[model samples]
Target: MKITFTFILLNLCIFISAQNDSINDKVISYDDKIILRLNLDTNVDDYVISSKELNIKPRLELNNQINTSFGLDYKIISATVSFAPHFFPGNNNNLKGKSSFTSYNFRFFPKNIIQTLSYKNSKGYYISNTQDFVSNWQKGKDPYLTFPNLRIQSFGGSTSYIFNKDFSLKAIYYQKEWQKKSSGSFIPSLNYEYLIFSDNQNSVKSREHQLNLSFDAGYYYNYVITKHINIAPFAFAGLGKKWSSYKSDVTKDEREKQNYFTQNFGAGIHLGYNSERLFFGSKFNYSGNHYDDNGSNILQNNFYVLLFFGYRLDPPSKVKKVYEKFQDKIPVL
Candidate 1:
């Protein structure tokens, strides 16, 4: 099933690439250069449960970890691999238990359209508000409630279109292009994901599967301060639907299915500097979503800061030859 889904998604992206239009002259293209980037970002996940009837709110979070990723961009395709290294200071906190995260992401830009696909896996989590549960819990000395066997895996993809030809999202994201002048765009996107949540606790195992779909309307503006510097800000809001199926080893009811409505919103800003061959950037973003789960409100929130430095190099002859060979068959290349 996974293989079939991936194949279909790839074909869909390829079909979308065929509909691409020409970019405006204000956007500088760097299709001939190969860009290598190093990125550092806080990759943390958090969940909050609130119950009005019980008059209590509890929060759960994964260990706060700094993730490092290596990215490569050549022509229309870009890819990144990310992992949480153990050598990072806060990643090894004993109070939060052990946690791990890994992700693989790819983006394809075909003129004015952008398509993205990603897979992420995370394990281990802990209740963050230990003092609320334990009256005498000492800070930094007491352990929080830990879910060492909890795991989450997701497969996701998104497709977006740039309505304004003068604006280049690639300038702010992948650095494959540069916007010569200030411009804004009303970009719209469709996102979909399949997620699995599983845990084994106290000898009882449970699992849940969810499929989600959302549509977002976003606006981004790139303000060119100078020839080598720019600032970009973006905001988006979306509504989604989630279909979930859950099962437990202790339940005789086999599987239970449920549907939920969700809403999400976020805003962010990026500051960047770009030269002939070197580029660096920093970004800060916050996002949150909420849904009703069995009469209780469940909310997920995320905030992260990212820093990246990248350098452009000339592609080798063999690499250029391979890309040229396939450019005719795959228009996205």
Candidate 2:
């Protein structure tokens, strides 16, 4: 199923590319749309009091272009992530699992606000060794299924705006609700990002979609390192309420109700080769606290990473000199 879906998506993207029209005018116009690629990310960090080491998952991304307009564009982007980790503050060396996704970017602005109205999604899957808040010591085989179904997510759509190529604010005030069904391990009550980095090239391309600002609001930013290797790092802080399944034996207080209240922040980096017809490269991002429940809100403290190879449907322009053969061609009457 994965192989066939990939093939069909790829072919559709190629067909879009051939139909793209030129955009020499100030208002960028386009048609060619279809892109796909693979990504990987790995980390070796020690967290908690004793030492919590981890090895996260990899990502598979797909973006199929549909159309374009001034400060407005349309494309669908989907990603999948799977990870395995080991915690050891208690010295328990067991592995865990996780995954999620996002789709479509419907906005664009090269020199302006770069506002976006796109559909966003997220989800995570996990399984633990022994059920406990604190980690257990003593390295052993994978204990990743004891507390399986630690979390599950299903949410979509919301409007967003960028301040510049590197910064902006967003709101998904009318986004649908979804949450995880885990014990001590939960999200929204604990929200988080895959990674954060600079993407001046807007490589992720989720800046356009269908929606409005009704419920959730957020802030984001980007930074560029080099023209050829642009970095666009962003951060998000939001507020909303959803349904979450906490510990059954815990207090039934409304404060602990599975409502939506989040303060998440992370950014991503885009390192691609740009031209008149193509912008192909890799991306990555990170955050300090997984769900911010750890209590540290400093933007420059913790971080994560993602690395992928991406290509745009329309290739950028390449500087080429006028050759003798083409230059000598006779003019038509």
Candidate 3:
């Protein structure tokens, strides 16, 4: 009887181990496969300055341009190149002004950590609230006050950690994996950025340099609707500090320094379908930032809708061999 009892206990242990492995296997991984993606998004940046004491508000916005991005993912790294195509309808409208935008971004996912780096450059802006300043401005016929020489550039990145081991952020973001069960995670991130803003107007060149740092606490939930469908919603809030330096060619007192406190919040939702080789998704996102500039309130905001489609293919033998050689030296790869 003692021997029979020991046998039963051993069998039970084996059964439980098999069940655990089965659950883990449901999360499909495409790490060995290469993925190519095409994305389209309406993501224009805008700035607003308002002063209650002066009863004045001015809004600056880029043209309504549609941006297209191409991305590639291999092993643990993902990279993307994005630009605004001139063939888009509103991009060629002279009423808004000639504008250009380009960006490059890369992301790495290793275990529970996510790392990102990016750079963006944009030129040209217009006063979106021209009606407020003009006496008899028509809605579609009148041209906006254009800033053809204005430009802005930024270099930024973020590092985030996921607390829940079962939740897969890459499943929703990069489409490199798929999660079978519904799960959520608390993700905390640290972000930093350096920005340059310059404009040459009326032959006077003015420039500003800024450094910003922020921390955010965010919650993301992946609700599995079916084996091939899911919807994810996320939100975050953060506080930050900005250090700024301003210089102008026209003024003898050319250097000025200022510091400001900033607050930001954002929320977004994504709906996606995933299959063995194909994945597609749509997302809607809104983000806003506020800071005080010399007693005047400055607000910058972005609202955009995005659509993406991607396909996975088998990696070539040469590519796999190269990655294997480096994987030992870099465990994260």
lDDT winner: 1
Q: After superposing candidate 1, which stretches have Cα over 4 Å from the reference? A: 1-21, 328-332
When 1 and 3 are scored with lDDT, the better candidate is 1
For candidate 2, report its TM-score. Answer: 0.39
Predicted candidate 3 versus true structure: per-residue lDDT over 14-43, tens digit per residue: 332321112255477787789999999998
lDDT of all predictions: 0.87, 0.28, 0.85
Which residue ranges in model 2 land beyond 4 Å of their true spot? 1-30, 41-137, 142-145, 149-151, 163-227, 243-260, 287-304, 312-333
Tens digit of lDDT per residue, candidate 2, span 245-284? 2322223232232222333354444444434344444545
The per-residue C-alpha lDDT of model 3 at residue 316 equals: 91
For every candidate, C-alpha RMSD to the true structure in Å = 1.9, 17.2, 11.9
Error (Å) of candidate 1 at residue 16 is 4.2
Query: How far in Å is the alpha carbon of 217 misplaced in model 3?
Result: 0.6
Candidate 3's C-alpha runs over 4 A off are 1-26, 328-331
Give candidate 3's TM-score: 0.90
